[model samples]
Target: MSTPRDLMIVALDVAPSRPLGRGDLSLALAGAEAYDLLRTGTVRLRGDRLAPLTGPGPDRLAPLPPPGPEDGLLAEAAAALVREEPYEPLPDWLWRRGRGLSSAYLAALEAEGQVTWERSRWLPFRGGRTVLSDTEARRRAAYRWAADEPVLLALAAAVGIREELTPADPAVTDDTALTVLAAVHDAVMELEAVRQRRALEAAAFANVWRGA
Candidate 1:
């Protein structure tokens, strides 16, 4: 029952039974979309050396070049992602990744029954809101990965959510599975440090203008 969005949702709701505030939803969605794009070859990440995986023929290490100008959120974020210094952490560089992607994966996650939204008691329309959700599936996956459960272990390894990263419990293990968890954590931290960071918000509003 777990979907790609759950990867981000688990990071947002570590506890199995609490509601998550909507303020961070934009950042969470960005992380989810980043993971999907990365997993599907829409983007690529190089270890340590950190050069973007995009270039000419043999030079084109990325599965696909970043999306174009009219392609929307993933494109915008990919454009920003390659600009960071090679020495910077991938998570840190992704603060601006996928600029207007906060809502794309959410509907899918909700449709899958992993989360539920309840209208705000006060400002039902634009005010702050939170959604109820759980992390059972992700937690279980993490636990299996830690225990070196064969199938999950291979999957995690193939994806770089290395076994050495997990502990004995069904825990986050530095939030590695989908890569989005760590990125979301960093993005939120970055957003907090610099409150003026409104690119995501601006892009979000712009979508409304385009009738998206």
Candidate 2:
């Protein structure tokens, strides 16, 4: 099934070398993956922890037969967390998940020849970098992106991308895409607020404790 994660992958047609913008693509992918699994009935979510639904397979947790690769990737990620932590909120799981996942996903796409990256050695840093081979070309073609759907637009806005969206946008109108986008946006914003509050509270506590 072509899910939001798939859209995210396409939207991020940036070469591995370029900045993937300000938002966290990994978190975006994880949320999309969890929502897709929830919709597909291959998995069930309990308080942020994703658990496989009982089925014919000997291992309920095995990556659901890839309706698409993103499914497998997301399943693998979720499964790993379930194994490590008994229960972790999806957002928390996303923050604590390992690095390089976004790169891995892009590499898989590169292997499929759907996209390509070029390795480059720039000055001031001996370590070379990889960049999307034709970022401008793909960007020009992406003009039609998310025209029919606004979930991705919502994601962009949530991450401070500031897309030009109308009141008719799914995020504003409360459409199906909103189900995914709003959930992601709300979760991310709520988490950020919680984190800020905690930081402030800690600072206050430290000031008092240190003074005493």
Candidate 3:
């Protein structure tokens, strides 16, 4: 029902040709969370920085309202908001909130019965694969994916799925949503760069050892 959950279901249901990296998916899920919170007026972007919406107060900056009870992970995310001046930048928020987010969502889905593990018919003793259950949540996510909803499509593209709507498509018109998508893209690329740098370092170390 939530954007992050819907994106996770879409990823599993679509099963893209190239496997998605968990890190990349986690970053996009964080972006999806930001998008949903923005849609609900829980947060807002001030020129690429994220700030939680506060209620009226004498100081003009009250505490953030609580997240809905149904989404515990989102509650945690809301609590993690940087509620001071010089609020956290969008890309930094994505990297911070996205840590291990994919695993958290997967565990939540499994516990909620939204996903189930099914063993292969031919290999009874082997490990089973988790699949989405036939539920309204899955159906709604599928419909959104089929419709190429801009937010979902942009998140999917950040995770390297090229089959759906491109991020450049004019479907997403909201300036705030577009900002979230751009931050997600930048974060993913930064993560990829880190991975490449680490790989190169490892290769150089191995070469030095071999020469010695």
Per-candidate TM vs. native?
Answer: 0.38, 0.53, 0.83
lDDT, candidate 2, 1-212, per-residue tens: 43443544555652333334323565565555655555665444443223446432211222233343355565576456453334445455445552444566667656655465444545434554344444443443354344544555555555444444567665445433344455566556665688789999999999999999
Task: State which candidate has the highest TM-score.
Answer: 3
The alpha-carbon lDDT assigned to residue 110 of candidate 2 equals 68
Q: Please, what are the lDDT tens digits per residue for candidate 1 over residues 76-158?
A: 55455444334335454444443434455555456666557777778677665446355565466455434654323322322
Q: Please give, for residues 19-104, the per-residue lDDT of candidate 3 as tens digits.
A: 68999999999999888777776776664223336532111111246553257777777777788775677778898889999999
Candidate-wise lDDT, in order: 0.46, 0.51, 0.80
Root-mean-square deviation (CA) per prediction: 12.3, 8.3, 5.8
Ranking by lDDT: 3, 2, 1
The TM-score of predicted model 2 comes to 0.53
Clashing pairs in 2: 15-132, 17-130, 17-131
Q: Which ranges of candidate 2 are over 4 A from the true structure?
A: 2-5, 14-23, 47-70, 81-86, 119-146, 160-166, 172-183, 186-212
What TM-score does candidate 1 reach? Answer: 0.38
Query: How far off is residue 118 in model 2, in Å?
Result: 3.7
Ranking of candidates on TM-score, top first: 3, 2, 1
Q: Which has the higher lDDT value, candidate number 2 or candidate number 3? A: 3
Number of the top-ranking candidate, with lDDT as the measure: 3
Q: How does candidate 1 score on lDDT?
A: 0.46
